[model samples]
Target: MTRAGTAPAVLLVVVGLACQEIGASFAVLLFPQVGPLGMVMLRLVFSAVILLAIARPSVRGRSRSDWTGVLLFGLVLVVMNGLFYLALERLPLGVTVTIEVLGPLTLSIIASRRASAWLWAGLALGGVAALGGGGWERLDPLGVLFALGAAASWAGYILASARVGRAFAKLDGLALAMAAGALLSLPFGIADAGSALLRLDLIAIGAAVAVLSSTIPYAFELIALRRLPAAAFAILMSLAPATAAIAGFVLLGQHLSWLEVVGIALVIAASIGAVRSSSRAARETAEPLA
Candidate 1:
């Protein structure tokens, strides 16, 4: 794709990451009342409803492989969201996001043959290490483990989404997968939130969280993934930790020290380097044909 074509995908990713962080901050505010499991349940249930209503996916005519892909995608979504919220319950948003980014960074590094890709990965890892170095003692080990689990699930989600996107037409696969996720999380949601889940105000907030965090970002990512290579997509998503830090400062009153600021800058630099590298590689590939 031309630079012009790639620009929109980049913009979508930026917007999606911003929305996701903001929604996450909002979810934190509700966590005390509903708990993490309840919050995940609300996000999945409402997001599933919105996507299913919009896509109206057909159940008929899907092959067993197609269903399998969708099921796997849904399972990944469930695990990713659950673990992320659980981590959020114990860790600062920025720190959690920084650790969770390792999953995609690992994916990108393994996918690339170039040594320069390893440099970018090293820079990103150094930044994350700096960000967490000072406050590691205060952070719960269990929370860190949860974030790592979310990271693994996120990597799975990325790979599964690409396959499911190809298998089913225009959001149908996403819709089905989201529905399956909702069903899978429903029991936990009920058990945790209880009657609080039925409150009108909580329901309204849950709906907004679903739209901001799940509906919008997922749609943007699914569309962007169709156009962007997985490695490129992962690099673009490197912005998440920086955005999460900003959201934490703005919404959660979490202050960052100079080291953390430098960490964010390093991650941003690595993302830019990755994008430029990918673009240059694309240009070189086309040059021979031209």
Candidate 2:
């Protein structure tokens, strides 16, 4: 695609990511009333409802493997969102996202055949170290752990989502998986939210969060992906930390140190490098022999 053609898709990606961070900010606000797990339940349940209504996926005649893929994807969604919200409770939004992104970065590194992958890995390590700013105690250890768990779950999510995508048509797989995730989260959401879940206002905000965080982004990305290359999309996704930091500052009054800023920049840079390397390798492998 020409540079001009790619511009709109790039903007869409940025807009979607910005919406995601904004939704995260809202989720953080709701945490006081619903708690983290409760917030997860609200987001997933609402997202599932919206998706299922749109897709209305048929349950009949699915292979065992299809069901298995959907189930595993659903479980990954629960773990990824649950851990992410839990980390948000303890850490600043920017910090949590920066840490959580390491999962995909690690996956990219592992998949890359180039020696440059190690250089990118080293850069990422440095960035992580910089996040501590000579004192790891400044960051909440438990929150960091939660973010790491979220990170791991994110990697699993990528794999599981791909599997489901191949096994089912269009949005059918995603809708079903999201419904399954909502069902699995019901116990914890109910336990944590209690009577607060009964409030109409809170339910409305939860629905908004689901739309901003999941629905809008998914729609935008689906459109953007048709125009943008996968590598370009991955590169654009790396900007999430910066957007998260901005949302944190504007919405939550969360501030970061200079070191942390540098750390986020480093991670973003490394992520882009890794993605480029991987894309190049894939292209080379796909080239026809002369």
Candidate 3:
């Protein structure tokens, strides 16, 4: 697409990611009342309801493999959200997001056939080490572990999303997977928050969180993906950590040290480098045939 045509999509992606981070900040405010598990359950339940209502997916003709993919995707969603919120309980939003981004970066590196991909991997490791310089004394060790677990689950989510997208039409797979995620998280949510989960005020906030974090962002991203080149979209997404940091500061008053800022920049650079390398490789392969 031309630069003029791509501009709107770029705006959409930026707005979507900003909204997602802002929504996360809001969820953090509710942590004392609902806890991370409750927040995850609430977000998943509301997101599932909204998607199912809009997509109205039918399961009549799906194969066993299709169902399997959806189930696996749902499980990944459950684990990813649960661990992410758990990490948020103890870690700054910017730091957690920076760490979690390693999941996709690692996946990209693993899928690439280029030797230079290792440089990006090393850069990302250096960033993580910088962030962990003071160890558990400065940052919660358990929270860091939870963030890493979320990162792993995010990688699984990416793989599963691709499979489920192939197996089902439109948003049907997403809706079904969201429903399954809500179900899987229901028990843990109830155990954590009990009857408090049913409070109307909390439910309202949760609904808002779901819209901002999932429904609206997903809609915007889907539209942007159709209009933008894959490489462009990937590069745009590499700005997420910076956005998260800004959102953390503006919405939550969470401040990062200079070291943390440098760490985040390194990770963001590594992510962008890995994506650009992959994109260049793809283009070169096509150029040879042309």
TM-score of each: 0.87, 0.98, 0.96
Candidate 1 vs 3: which has more TM-score = 3
Q: Which tens-of-lDDT digit does each residue in 18-64 have in candidate 3? A: 98999899999989888899999999999999999999999998899
Q: Order candidates by TM-score, high to low.
A: 2, 3, 1
User: In lDDT terms, which candidate is top?
Assistant: 2
Ranking by lDDT: 2, 3, 1
List, residue by residue over 1-290, the lDDT tens digit for candidate 2. 56666999999999999999999999999998999999999999999999999999999999999999999999999999999999999999999999999999999988888999999999999999988866889999999999999999999999999999998899999999999999999999999999999999999999999999999999999999988989999999999999999999999999899999999999999999999999998888889753
Compared with the true structure, what per-residue lDDT tens digits does model 1 show for residues 116-165? 88798888777776776577666688998999999898889889999998
Task: Sum up the clashes in candidate 3.
Answer: 0
Clashing pairs in 3: none
Error of 1 at 5 (Å): 7.9
How far is 173's C-alpha from truth in model 1 (Å)? 0.2
Displacement of residue 183 (Cα, Å) in model 1 is 0.3
lDDT of 2: 0.95
